[model samples]
Target: MKAAKPLPPYLVRRYQGWKATTYSENSTWYKHLANEGQHPRAMVISCCDSRVHVTSIFGADTGEFFIHRNIANLVPGYEPDGAQHGTSAAVEYAVTALKVAHLIVLGHSSCGGVAGCMAMCSGHAPELLEKSSFVGRWMDILKPGYEKVKDEPDPETRQRMLEKEAVLTSLNNLMDFPFVREAVEAQSLSLHGLWTEIGAGALEYYDPAKGGFYPV
Candidate 1:
């Protein structure tokens, strides 16, 4: 393997600054965490979008939340084919090993992955239809979401709805894992779905009783 390129100078400077100030202030806490290992109570599966700041939104400190970011914040149905499954592996470790009490799927507005799924489903993105296209294949997780909102007359509303659907789809798929289902049934673990409005900084949470999302 070839040697990897060094980090950008700006990032190195920012890291140095954090190490000098933030790390200095919390040196004891960081040392404790490193010694004890993490025991986060919740696992947050959020989007890869840079705008979706999980820690900032929840006001979480280091070692508080076990976070996994992926395209559209999706959780694929359990498929133990012995293939390389990063998201599933993360979920397995968080649940079976870490014993996290809650797992939250966090989606957001204006998601490019959701838009790509919509485009692919609506036949607008032929390139994404190819089997080898990684983005297209990953976006396939949102196909069910597209089907749910494909009939809407307004395009903008449909797109927004699909974004929310991504959260719902992941929540549903999380249950498909046998361990997750057992844990939920045993009342040992809980699953949650959340959607965020990037520009408004508003959040909506899924209500199982209402079968929809409500402002939080």
Candidate 2:
């Protein structure tokens, strides 16, 4: 097979700069992290959006949190059918292997994936109905969320509501995994849902009692 292409020159230059500055300044600490395996106390399953920087948002360092990124930051109901389930596999490793005490699902406003689901479910995006569309199939997980907010008349409100619903949907799905359920039930693990208004730099966390996301 032919070799893969190299990274763009800008990325190469950035990496070189990082190696010279950040890596050089923290070489010993980096080596220590390599020698001692990660023991993160939390795991964050978040969207693949470039604007959602998990590390920056939490002011985290290396070996801080186990994180997984996927479109819409979704989690599917547990299906141990032996198929390749990337998100589920990450959850399993974090909960059972890494033994993280907290699992967080972070969703953001104006999510393209959520918008796609809204469009598709409303019969506006026929391509997503195609059998070969991976994104469409993956986004089917959010249809139930759409159903809950389908009647909201205001477009912006509906969009915002659906985005938050994505977090709730994922939180509900996480319970389907036996390990996650056992750990949560045993008080060893806790689940959290968070939403952010990226442009405004505002963050809100879900309160099970309040039944809404509140400012943090």
Candidate 3:
């Protein structure tokens, strides 16, 4: 086993403060929540990157949003199985258990996973090709988006385009869930796609009018 790295002093101090504040101020609510159950109004599917916190980004408090984090925030079409699924399980709990009113597929710029997918496209990481089917599978989801901006003159531009395309594709995939589809058709639920840029701290809102993402 690898040795654990020591926590930075600042982070340790911050955790102490956060713990103190949370226990003192929110203990009653949390205790009730632990006993009764969670009641959230929305479900946010976001990347596993440390920088993109769905609750903090949206200023949501506990019990307001059910969150699921994954490599690229990809939403696969729903499948019923006895198998354990990280993303699908969260979706099932949110839709069936919590009955969230909205589901948001949140994507971000400078995503390492999307970058990995882009690298896979260039025939690099051949070891990844044979052993790791994940990147290939994810890139396959973005195939339509890849085709959309494949002709872009700059390679960097193409990757950025692909990144946005992956977001759109994931949003589309979210709707493929039967519960989500039913809720949406019944007008009880809504779906949204959000694109956030880490470097610029700029959020791009997906616009149906422009048929592309735009700065918010």
Candidate 4:
């Protein structure tokens, strides 16, 4: 077998050029950010998918948004853990330290993890569900959505539907945290659910008026 070719030197040079441009363009903000620390206005919970970067899509600048990513952007009902909860820890810091005014739970179409959750609903082995590992247990958080939509006519189509429904489900679960609930009640914070389709490059926002998601 032939060894793989190395990346072109031109590509590396272009990245270096862009890095210089970014530093020059964002010098003031970067300087202040380094000194003052991050005080993001919102916190974003999104998937770990490389295609679904929240900052790039939203045109966010440095220190503007506190973000946490995991398999399928799950919030696990605010567990009282002895160790650290990465997602919850980011949320707590965003709320308390940054005084974030919004918490957005972002889900997207064509998510592999969502498909995995759907697969679990299709009668996987007991040992698979009993693994007690991170991904397996995290998928359990979206079980209600999977179960609710499992009996649909087509498994593939239902999986897609469940992906969107799971976003709403997780948003509802965010309120299970007392701090999140209090912030909402006081009108100091708000929660939002968003869905994006990677293939079409279209975005959707949850519309409370219609009680459904609509393209933005």
Candidate 5:
């Protein structure tokens, strides 16, 4: 493979500083993790948004959470067809191999992917309608979620509703995986849905019994 371009000076300096300070301070723990392998208790699937910090929010240390970040934090319905499915592969590893006790789907407010799905479904983003658009194809997972909130009269409310729907949709889709279902039925694994208010640092959790998200 061709040599990759060097990182920007600012980022290189930042990494050097981290290596001199944080890495030195936690060198022992880092080495232990490398040698022992990870045994994270929970697997957190969250959005790729830069603002969402899963470790900071949970006060978790390295090796505590197996995290997977993707646009809109979606989990597609199970399809056994042979294909390259990054999310499914990660889920399989986390559940079947790692045996994580908890699977958390973490969504957040002001999600771009959710907004894009809303726009595409509302006939606003014509470019996303093209078959070759990767984001369009990925956001298709959340299209059903848009349908649930499209009827809401207020645009802001609709957008917020869809954000929460993204969490619920992922939670439901988790069960579509046979291994996930088996784990749940065996009471070995549990699923949760969470949504965060990015600016306010507030979190809400989904309640299956109530069929709504409640502040946490």
Candidate 6:
């Protein structure tokens, strides 16, 4: 096996900068977190898109949130066949072990995962349809969401609708977990859906009453 390489000079410099500034300023808080444990108030499941900064959006500090990120920010329906499920495991740990009060599914505009799902479902992305494409299989979780906006005339609008649909779909699928359902039913946990626009830095939240997303 090849020996591991050291971090690049630029990344090392960035880390040193952060350690000198953010870490130095909050060393006590960091020490406290190390001594005590993380007791985050919420769990935010967001897309892996680099533009979507979950903590920055909420002004959250370290140890304040239990965050899980994945492609399309999806949560698949409960499947107990013993296959490895990273997202499901994170949700289980957050709900049962962390006992977070709020569980949020955060989707975003201009999501490549959503676009790939659209392309695959529309027969436009042959590569993604291949069995070897992990992204394609991962995005299969959003197929139900794609059906909601497949026929929309405007491509841009359809993408936006599908983005929100991803959030809604995840919120629905999250209930499939027995632990999540029990917590929600007993009023110990609440579920939320959010969509954000990367360019405008605008945010919209799903309102179950109106069955649509509204600016926040």
Q: Candidate 3 on 100-128: residue-level lDDT in tens? A: 88888888887777777766666775654
Model 3: per-residue Cα lDDT at residue 53: 78
lDDT tens per residue, model 2, 1-216 = 468788999999999999999999999989998999899999999999999999999999988999999999999989999999999999999999999999999999989999999999999999999999999999999999999999999999999999999999999999989999999999999999999999999999999999999999
Error of 6 at 97 (Å): 0.1
Flag regions of model 4 displaced more than 4 Å: 1-15, 124-127, 130-132
Candidate 3 off by > 4 Å: 1-15, 81-83, 133-139
Residues 1-216, candidate 4, lDDT per residue (tens digit)? 488886799998988897799878888988999998888888899999999989988999879888999999888777886877887777887877788999998899888888888777676644447777567688898888887788899866887788787788878878887888888999999999899988887888898789988888
Q: Count the backbone clashes (under 3 Å) in each candidate.
A: 0, 0, 0, 0, 0, 0
TM-score winner, 1 or 3: 1
In model 1, how large is the Cα lDDT of residue 173?
91
State candidate 6's TM-score. 0.98
lDDT of 4 at 118: 77
In candidate 2, position 39 carries an lDDT of: 93
| Predicted candidate 6 versus true structure: per-residue lDDT over 1-216, tens digit per residue | 478898999999999999999999999999999999999999999999999999999999999999999999999889988999999999999999999999999999999999999999999999999999999999998898888799899999999899889898899999999999999999999999999999999999999999888999
| Candidate 1 Cα lDDT to native | 0.94
lDDT order, best first, reads 2, 5, 6, 1, 4, 3
Per-residue error (Å), model 2, residue 90: 0.1
TM-score of each: 0.98, 0.98, 0.85, 0.87, 0.98, 0.98
Compute the lDDT for candidate 3: 0.79
- Minimum summed lDDT over a 10-residue window in model 6 is located at 1-10
